[model samples]
Target chain A: MTTTTKNNEPIITVRGLRNTFGEQVIHENLDLDVRRGEILGVVGGSGTGKSVLMRSIIGLQTPDDGEIEVLGESMIGRSEDEAKNIRRRWGILFQNGALFSTLTVAENVEVPIREYFPYIRPPVIDEIASYKIAMSGLPANAGPKYPSELSGGMRKRAGLARALALDPELLFLDEPTAGLDPIGAAAFDELIASLQKRLDLTVFLITHDLDTLITICDRVAVLADRKVIAVDTIPNLLALDHPWIQEYFNGPRGRTAALSHKEGAAA
Target chain B: MAANGAGKARSSGVLPTEFISRTTSRDMADVNGTSDDHQGESVYRVAGALTITRAATTQREIDALPDPLTIDLSEIDRMDTVGAWLVYRAVRDRGAKVVGASRDEVSLLHQVSEFDVPARVRPEESSSFTRVLTELGEWVADAGSTLLGLLGFFGATLIGFANLIRRPKRFRVNAVVQRFDVVGVRALGIIGLMSFLIGIVIAQQGSVQLEQFGAEVYTINLIGRITVRELGTLMTAIMVAGRSGSAFAAQLGTMKITEEIDAMRTIGVSPIEALVIPRMIAAVIMMPLLAFWAMLMALLGGGIFVWLSLEIPPLTYVQRLQEVTPITDLWIGLIKAPVFGFIIALAGCFQGMLVQGNSEEVGLRTTTAVVQSIFLVIVLDAVFAVFFSSIGWR
Candidate 1:
């Protein structure tokens, strides 16, 4: 896996993105870019179009009005095979870790690996599957267990392993720590940070958790009024004059932000 | 008493007894002023314009109120917080001291009225056993009804499969091959063991009966006829229903729950192409092969039992088998296999795609798929049997 950082280049760029359901406009002229090797945390209150933005960028949701370019290829109006091919360049960690329930953890990790790289020997696939599982911070023995037997956090790790199976250049996570307790959420955040560093992955994370944003994200994009109100480092984002932003960054949330930055700085 | 007059004097403004009587409505105040109006004592009433407040505030007022205070609400034509809470609190906080509290008063008083407040007069929780059994009964009934509906769906699927020979695209070899891996390849060990045991039981029973008739050689025919005509098709269908049918429901159900189908739509991936086509193809291919495997096991099991009990040589057994059945018999069985396969796969995947609930719906649809697939296979077999017999093929 290549670890060279491409900080100046934008791997994913969205211009004037918009999506509406019924009378509720989820996104209105939203514009953002996920730069190479940067962890961008997309944050907003519920219904502020965080997940919608991520989905649109990943070509999982069609934008009503926008141009999306990933890996310099236009994502709109692509063929199914083309879309799948584009998808191969990126990885997604679903909110609930949408692991295949019928498969064991090892087989779950092996899905993308086998689907995309079927020529690899079975023993090598097993080895790769086991390595990815361990990389996600799960025990080696966890690979043989079905999804039902594993705990919530374990399922998430297994899901992350699957996402990382293709060694994606860009990774998208939706509410990755949604239901986990503080301890679990913190550990997951660490795993994400380590993976990002080791694999040189550009992560676009959507989360409501202030702690996660403060602790892990290199840049935070605050979505409000159907577009990004601010996009900068957590400290700079906190310095915005918007009342809601001020309250968000200066209150309990801001403390989490400061703590996370400190930890990152210390690390 | 004399205190009644003083009580009127202590209020915000002291009013004459006659003035108070005129101000308070007939319903608001105890008209008769009889303390012993109800079987219970302490009938409390509030008379004035009323508004509502929270239960906690009501409790505070009730605690401050004197015992046996008769709250006359009829006089409260335009009651506000004072009248509503004072009356409600008296009833809730002071059981004997509060009485005649109406629903309107309570509704107006409780701040968080959405919750269950004011415990039942006779508070008694249900026993665990009764509660458990009641839940169990509901679950079982729900499961049973869902299974029945699934079976009906499977029956319809079988009819479609039978018609597939007329339209080859409906049951393509590639599709069948894919399903063969899922339903047949994946399920070999389980199906083989089950059929093998069932075959042994059938042979043992046939041997006992044939021995009584002093003609054990015909036991071979009995085994062949039973295995090929019914058990092979029926058992394979059942196994597929239990294994593949439920799998489809769960796979589809999880995707449905996760909004993956929606995701696919956004990415321009046809859900039918991405999900249904692959599973359908797999089922179409696997069913016949599984049936073939099951038939061979059943025969092997029966052959072993006959060779041991009847002392019939293996060659003699093979010769006896040739006398009763033929390649056409195998073809008939093979024909039913794919039809059964399509039914189980279609029923399972269809039911799976139909899943709506959370994880709970997956288990529900799975059971439904299995039952529906099996039922449809059997019904289709019966129709085929009659149709083939009438045409003189059987």
Candidate 2:
């Protein structure tokens, strides 16, 4: 079915996805696709279910009804082993960097590697984990520190390293820049952009950070009114007359991001 | 031309499109059957995706070709990391032959193959004896700190009590009453039902055993003595440890995590007085009352069981219960209640206050609180039993 798209295949494809909590409809007939080797940004107002949408795709939150496919495998009703296999292929960095409090940063990075690649020697796993930690932009000495000891930004990096433990093809980030300062957030955005290119990762980035969208995202999907209203490049999105999109993109913050992006491109 | 096609991407490496063009959609050489791209001798034309998602099919297509076959990179469309890896694997298998990839493809393929697995170095394993010694040392340190924490909390509560005595306006009466209503009043149904069933089991079991010695009437003595002296307060304490003890840990631990306790301290409000002192006072006041209620429920259950099964009348059961159980037994049991309550409350508050960070800490500490409280309760009961036995209470 996807062969008709000509060149690139979607790493993730969701068609008519619906999710609700009791009478609260979070998403309805929502559709999205994360193409391979593309950083796709998901943006929405609060309570529009950006996290809920990510959670659904990752199998953390089950949708009420929908079709979700990842790498040609249906994710909606997949068995545990199948789901586990899919999970092994992709990694999710939660909003708060939910690293296990008991483990050091290095050990946290080794969790998925240990789970999926049990035959790999612990020493090799340790080496790979450290490499991944370094790759995620943390210093070599940061690996021994506990999550609680690290700053908010450092914890997010540790979580990214842990997510990249298996060298996943796809990366899901939930508000990666939510808690960081502007410079830190921009650095994070650059780190993600570099990592995506180096690893050929298909990134599903859920963020409220306009700078992240302008800097890294190849395409941005706007979620509104319980479904995806528009999916296009930031430039194309800016031209839309949708009230929410207009306010969100033409707001002071959005204007600053656009100006900075133009200056960055020129520089 | 190659640089122009690579677009504004900062990385000079072959973008996924390093292998772009020449597939024409009709011939998916990489995914299915090999297409004839007779660029040169021994050329195996590849097309379509060669990424990780389709690595299996793509690898199979590459493998089916004759050895020493060259992969025509120009015939391929998209080549990602895994796709590059599979191509590299083919190249490694073929043992280096003539190659012709676009500049982008060559660079990407080169970078992809650079991901090499390094040698492993095992972590050092400590000797079992040394590990055990270290563990023992840590345990002792932990015990000391825990004891100190409990004592410190106790002293803080006492000082708060003194302050409250001096100026009653500092008291959070509403909070104290709320804690009392939740901890004391809410737990009644479960405590009552459990005691009644325990009473029935004791009475029935005692009657059977005593009947063997032609002393069936001694069921009264067994029920009265055991319920008043041991089971009443002991069971109530254990139940509260599970119920209210864990609650206190969770509540206070959550407060600590959310910085509410820190906020209180910042505002010159003592957490001990506002949180711990109220719970302690409530427990101290309620434990004796709850134990007395549990004792009555147990006696009622015992009376009903004996009357129904052993043909003992209710009036006779009551009179016999009074004769066997002295008022001193009641006092001994009631006296232990407050002490047990204080210990349970202290255990919960200690663990709760110990919470350093995270929601998981709250949960872990809550479990620890319940376990420590119940173990302490049983230990206290045993200590009291020994003291009463030494004084010839029985």
Candidate 3:
């Protein structure tokens, strides 16, 4: 609900993006522009390539054809060495956490810092890691525990801690609240919103949680028919006559989410 | 004079300050800044980008500054959480006041200060001597419990067998046959080649020693007795333990991790009967047959080597083998085979059932299965050797 003044200049620009896996086409001629300092929630039905689009932007999956400009750097066809500087500016949190199984939560957070700034002393890195871990809402004791030792929710927080370790300008969260309970999901959404505001981050979020969309997202982009069908605020999107978008926002669960959001805001 | 002296002191303090000014450039140089006024107050100016990449240098500078400090951040081009943390920690610990920070930088510093929980980076490790002693004690206790667990598993397997016998309709014919194809049929080629090569090496070595005594024909006796009574079943057991025992542990461990075994239990299907029993039965039934086949292959290899290298005919070699290798030697080898097979399968399945937690447990359990089964097989073979000798079977 706290709206930071976002700039008009796009932090990320995608045009004519096409992606395919063997015979299956996931996207074609997709266009998206994520403005600076805004949390853009991406939503679609299952198997509509929400994750695939995220992967394409992060350079994990190379698109057959596209132009991707992130922070004014062309992302397509760039080698790893060339992408290192740009890569450092963004952090990604995969679904299910995808934490390193062997390292503890604190150690996982330290990994990115150590890799980027090897000259930093161990004590400083440790202090920074603890700060990030606490900022992500994990308990202090959860630092020493491995990924396997924690619950699904704790693991996701640990993953977020690692993602925010370097104070990345851009953050990519794939289903940040997918497996969380209702209360836990709301807390996570609040954390994301607060962190984005404090750090001036441009968040590209993929989610299925209606409450998340209604509560925190500055804008929602709908993926359908192998491309983003519409991109606008939830109310504006609801006004449109797109069938999928209509059902998505006005559905039973969506109505309940909207009502609760309104009630919470009123209170 | 006082104002001029304060101006000189402030200029000297700010002029020599070394910092990286540009984001892309790594060059360190003096940047613009102004310190405290005419009063005796102490102020430190931080210039350039205060980010993670320059955290080491910034931390050192922050630590070296005098107490009752006022940090000036007006010259900072960029600032991140790491930089904010550095500034926040100084202010909190040293009671320093921060001035001239941008709105965004002030918020970032405030946010970093809010997360001021003391967290241990790693688990506390005990002293090396105590750790070693503790590890040794834990290992012994683990081994003791593992032995007891294996015995309990054996009892469970026996109960499973009894239940299947009581209800013959519950027997899984397809599962057992599939296990037979995996544990027995597929292992034929490698086991055969290994036994054949071992036979040739033994014959070649034995003939050389016998030739010195002008009794080269005795090599046939050595090859026949050793292959039939000891090497055939023992080597085959070792190979099967390496190949099939490790696989059983890995498969079952994966199933346990994925909760497939739990699902089976919920559906009223016994994993012991569905998974372990089929593998156990197949190993028990196939070991003696594989051992017998290995013994024949070894004899054929030795026969061929003797015929080619020693100029002895295949017929003569076969006749000598028949005379030296008694029926009791074959019985001894075949009798040991089923016992070895049972131990291998039990060790594998036992380790697999013990696996919990992540996929790493599967790899560890698989390794333990192969090692424990092979060690038990060798120990049991030694016992069989003593018992057979005492019974005058040799």
Candidate 4:
């Protein structure tokens, strides 16, 4: 929780990362840094390797060539035991929630806690899961429901609860608000912001939602031309001359998002 | 309270030493120093950070203390939500009063307490005997419904065929041809090998049994009659059930899951006509041909086995096979082949169309398709046997 001491250090640093599938190169010489305790929103066109970059950093996909350092530890070529120790420090929420279909929500939340901290008793684990479920804005009864029984929005919240189970210092969320209605998306944005502040989590969020980027992200990283074109605040990014960036943040949806955010702040 | 005491007793005895050391060394908390104040109430002072890592040990320590306790959190430097939850549970369940919690800790404790409603972890289960009876009842109902559903599917397939006859241009010739390749052409190698081996076995075993009667030459009659009348179509049906039947279920099941079938429906395309009819046509036409091929291969195999082992000439073996095997046997086998194909395709498509919800259903329906079709084929084979014998075809 020593946020001040680590405030300037980058929690994730990628250098000269290159990824290719057959002949299609998704990323090449891509470099980016995620600072500590910041919600870094990564935006890119489809097929520009936004997910690929996230996958590479999370060790799900091996890069053809690059250096990835997370939490000051080199992430490449690490043994399974070494990788597991680092993996326990972060949690990821995939786009589709990816909740285990068989287990109930409470049991899903307990999976990581039981795996890592087996000494914690079941009742305590249950209590922790309940609170996490509530904190993610789900009703108490959602803890008993299976993933298939829950709607898409509730499933995402359950996924969020499970991701927060370990009280992870870092979180990776892929399209957390992709399919939600506007109000739900806004509420989700606020929830993530509050959780980030309360838990001192450094968030690596991959999203296409302009509202989320405008409302919560401390800085935005733009992916284009097979690499990150720019990483800056929304206002700073708006000042850039890149056509894709200009069109993206000043598009009709983007303007509406910015206007609503301003109105929200004023109100 | 009694349960808490027992839990503490068991946990404390079996608690790993490393866990205790890890918790205490980093976020060390002293649970001692119970004092009696002027009000005559016991005070439990918890020191250092209380987090999830130390949750088990902390809960145990709190459970062991006497009732009407005052929890002192003034000395704690840091606390997370898990820590707050533990403190909240202790206060709520044991009626402990907080002495000096920070404003943030109090808010966190309140937040955690607001969500503390009883939620069931798993569904309630009845007694084992009742559960078994209930499962048996459900299975019977399911089987009954499945049989009706299969009949409905067969009716729909027949209607689709009638429509195709009315509008011959609408018939999916390409799809049926593709299915022909998959269900028939690709199956020749395995079916040929299996029938050949079975033919050799029958010839070898028949010769041994007939040797005692000094009628070893009658092995040709056994091989020809059995292969042509029973094993040829029967084995082909079982193999096709395992191969093409399972594939039809899986393909259609996946299509249903992904909403491809629904997409076709919205586009005014009947999935029964587009997907099921082609497969049915291919299976029906290919089955008889494949069965005839299997019979020929078996006879050739038997001919080879007799020539090698019994020193019977190939021409003599062929002549014996023709004389001993009646045309009626081949007729029965061919007539049964299409019927078996129809049942296999119907079961496959029926199970597939029934699939809904998850990808797991595809696997389950595929297995059902194979088992149900094979079972029905055997049952029908028996019925066919009885009918043919009553007609004196035996």
Best model per TM-score? 4
- Expressed as tens digits, the lDDT of each residue in B74-106 for candidate 2 is 545555544565676666556533244555456
- DockQ-based class of model 3: acceptable
Off by over 4 Å in 2: A1-10, A81-85, A101-107, A114-124, A142-149, B1-125, B386-394
lDDT of 4: 0.86
lDDT of 4 by residue, B1-394 (tens): 0001101111123323211111221132243333234244565677766777777888888888887666777666567778877777877777776645554455556656767776666556799999999999999999899988888898999999999999999999999999999999999999999999989999999999999999999999999999999999999999999999999999999999999999999999999999999999999999999999899888888889999999999989988888988999999999999999999999998899989987778999999999999999999999999999999998
Who is ahead in TM-score, 2 or 4? 4
Comparison by lDDT, 1 against 3, better one: 3
Q: Lowest-scoring 10 consecutive residues by lDDT in candidate 2 chain B?
A: B1-10
Predicted model 1 interface RMSD: 32.8
Better of 2 and 4 by lDDT: 4
Which digits, one per residue and each the tens of the lDDT, describe model 1 over residues B243-323? 888888888889998999889889985565556656766776777778888998998888888888778877887888888
TM-score of predicted model 1? 0.44
lDDT over C-alpha atoms for residue B237 of model 4:
96
DockQ measured for candidate 3: 0.41
Could you tell me the lDDT of residue B378 within candidate 4? 100
lDDT of 3 by residue, A198-225 (tens): 7778899999999999889999999999
Residue A259 miss distance in model 4 (angstroms): 0.9
Error of 3 at B96 (Å): 3.4
Where in model 3 is the C-alpha error above 4 Å?
A: A1-5, B1-43, B66-68, B207-216
* lDDT digits (tens) for residues A92-151 of candidate 1: 998878988777888888888678756555544565566667668887678777777788
